[model samples]
Target: MAISPFRIYDIASTFLQHSLHLTSTLHFYARSKNEYSHGIIYVRRLSMNLNDYLLNKHLLLVDDEQELLDMVVSILNEYGFYNITTAKSIKDAIEATQKLRPELAILDVMLPDGNGFELMKQIKQYSDCPILFLTACGEDEDKFKGFGLGADDYIVKPFLPKELTFRIMAILRRSYKSENPIVKLKNSQIDFSSAQVIKNNEHIQLTAKEYDLLSALYRNAGCIVTIDALCEATWGANPFGYENSLMAHIRRIREKIELNPSQPVSLITVKGLGYKLIVE
Candidate 1:
């Protein structure tokens, strides 16, 4: 059964509140032999999956240039991510996030109503999702200011499509890896350790980027991880140029896991905030 977004939130909250107390099982036993001996204790975690995770994330693209926004959207669509919502100004961006939380936000440094840097701060108040600055202002100070504001990645204008996508892919991967490797979502199973996904009796290998993005999302299972967080995790401290790469990887991943990639139920979009892994 499909879990309601509200229910997802409620259960996740409850799980976090009591995660520590779940150690009901005794972790040690006495040595009957009376000889001094050393022993080890192990704890096993529940199975969690990240397949179909990124494809369902809601991406917010903010820019005053219609052409740039359209091009980015086209790239994302080609990659199988269809849940993006666009805005041309800071006001619209704020409103959009409030109505639909984005997992990742792309903001052009310059907007008609307001600049992306200022808007980014305001957006942060609404959602903790990662923000990327896509603008022509490539000065040292601009980069410094962006990073200081906790922006995940900063891309200068005239960027290559491939590079953009790759950076995004890298960010999403790092942001979402849940540490646990096995994920069960929909009718498919994804094993990051093995780098393969099993669906409908077929075994498919995951690309390097696909695996990374999955790990990022899975790391934050039952929650929204910002794109900036993802990029930083995947591409390191200088993850400014690979936003578009993320979309391509997400699309490929969905094809491997979703029974109906056109309409995924396992990977769900959470408006302007981020993606959530629905674990029952």
Candidate 2:
């Protein structure tokens, strides 16, 4: 039986407000039969309470098990994660990615027909948001495979909901705290506030490393920044091992920004050291 979007939202909202004590002004909209949106209900900085659960954060939960999905969403709500979206299949999951673009994604390893690993790849192609696998497949090999696919954390199923909540919160906190603010480049244009670069009224998508490198250069413009500085700025202290990675990031950024990346004008390399941005 197909659940009407309106009824699903009504139940979700009532459950949050009455059951969880989250007095967020939720705007629940039916995205589709298999997709539901419960937008952020409130934001208050000073008074730390359960309201801290879902303030200004978006989370996407993908699982094939209806009970598991509801349980996950319920747990998240209990922790003040009211801003949640649910998907029961790979197709629904991909659609949710486009519609919601969540800051964090909790994926189950085995779907009905599709695997979470496949979905992770598609998500990575567009978003660098932290992904945490919540799967029953807890074999050592399975754990390693999830990590190799760029999962930030992998949790074995049949675990405590509170523990899962804590893991998600910790991952979210780490991801948020380490973000480098995007530098607004020339012409009242090119907003880097998010990872994507917007220039000439178009969004020039950048890889995670590319975005980070460009942000570092933009922030420290006009100074002859050294390679070490760039490396440390992007990857933290002891970035000597990842010099090649840094170079690739820089080259990619140049391609997006410079008239010709081959013969760069804006992002120039200083032979022995690093690179600098000449914002025009």
Candidate 3:
């Protein structure tokens, strides 16, 4: 969470391979010490720590190339974006959006079922979250079509990951369009502009993963975020083995933002489904 944006941008910009192989399914990996860890962290806001504004908005990344998808996920992680849901096809993207309700989507021009343009039409039915075209096609016609369909941003492939990161952050900023970048929770307040928490006159700091999880739950605010969804928000494509870790993180987070960790009202468990962060 304390990682520098330039550090991640530098690594992503210089990465040789844009994808990785894990369990026969491709995912992105960085040429670094912990290759599989989710790479980025941030919450949401229109200013100050812009990356913080990149936080828990559920992001949908649609592309057929598992390798490229993985690579992008890694770079996004480094940018402090963890609450990501991925799809390899138009059908999958549509289905995931229905369930995930992403606030933003990064789409590839071409997918196995169809193209990003078609997918864009489908997604807009469910969300007005800004959509971005991250594809290899740089033709003027394609760009015009994308913008015509109201694309928020576009980037050609074989491009610098740093540029991609910046574009995403910029879109997030504009998407928020915060007349007021603050929200009040039951026991605390979230200031997205500064990525800070205020309760009992104390300023609380959340660890990276904790903030990521909070952002995930917060995005769905009065709704339940499934355990699987929460894990994906923090761990990306490989989330099966992190249930216990998610539990631990939730406990730690309650300690920071809850008036009583033992009986949390703000971050409540939904039992069989998942968790919900009920902001007052």
Candidate 4:
């Protein structure tokens, strides 16, 4: 059975308030089912962590309601976004964009000074960051206009926090996927997609085990990943008795990624714990 828009809003609003612990004052507005035919509900299992580099990207949020801005910012912060700038007016938003170009922007359609479509044009003049429209305006015309203006995604407000973040993540992934695969180190860089290391303008291929181990370490770069954890990442569930093998792979990996394999710098042994990858 097709779910009604009001029902969808109720379920999402309840989840936002109870599961996300958002304030009761966070209001939700729902559009008719016909308006939702454009497909607004986006929920996905994000394969990202708090330490993901994408979380560090700068975000600009423009909304006229201070309360809504605060709530949205708080939700994004909880989702591992630290660099966010909010503006209640187009003027402030443009000013913020000029000062610091955001990687992504969330905009409300109706602003006190001007509308979001106009602000998007002004922002594009400065930076080509992906924009998502988050507003109470759910009319088909508004959606078409926003998309026609080269907006990356259009989301109507009183949205689920997860849905909003998911759309943002999806847009960012699509926009920045090419740059996200390469892990830069002090001396060399690891390309996860190609499963190779680039050092001295040479492409060094990584073995399957080596690739798995390096991927695990790169994911938790600058932090100690325990021996058991590393083993599980490379080996299967029954990862017993792979310590010596892990050590051997690490040595070979250091030879490829390190300036001096004998005395490794980028890949450091944590002395009785595990290993850490220090990226540049």
Clashes of each: 40, 4, 15, 0
- After best superposition, candidate 3 residue 125: deviation in angstroms? 0.9
Report the lDDT tens digits of candidate 4 across residue range 38-151.
222311111224336576667898898878987887678556564567788889888888887789999999999989999999999999999999999999999999999999
> TM-score, each model?
0.48, 0.51, 0.56, 0.55
Clashing pairs in 2: 25-41, 53-80, 54-80, 227-274
Query: Candidate 2 or 4, higher TM-score?
Result: 4
Candidate 4 clashing pairs, residues 3+ apart or interchain: none
**Candidate 1: residue 171 Cα off by (Å):** 1.2
What TM-score does model 4 achieve against the real structure?
A: 0.55
Off-target runs (Cα >4 Å) in candidate 1 are 1-51, 179-280
lDDT of 4: 0.75
Q: Global lDDT of each model?
A: 0.65, 0.67, 0.71, 0.75
- Higher-lDDT candidate among 1 and 3? 3
What's the lDDT for residue 99 in model 2?
A: 72
Candidate 4: lDDT of 89? Answer: 88
Evaluation by lDDT, superior candidate among 3 and 4? 4
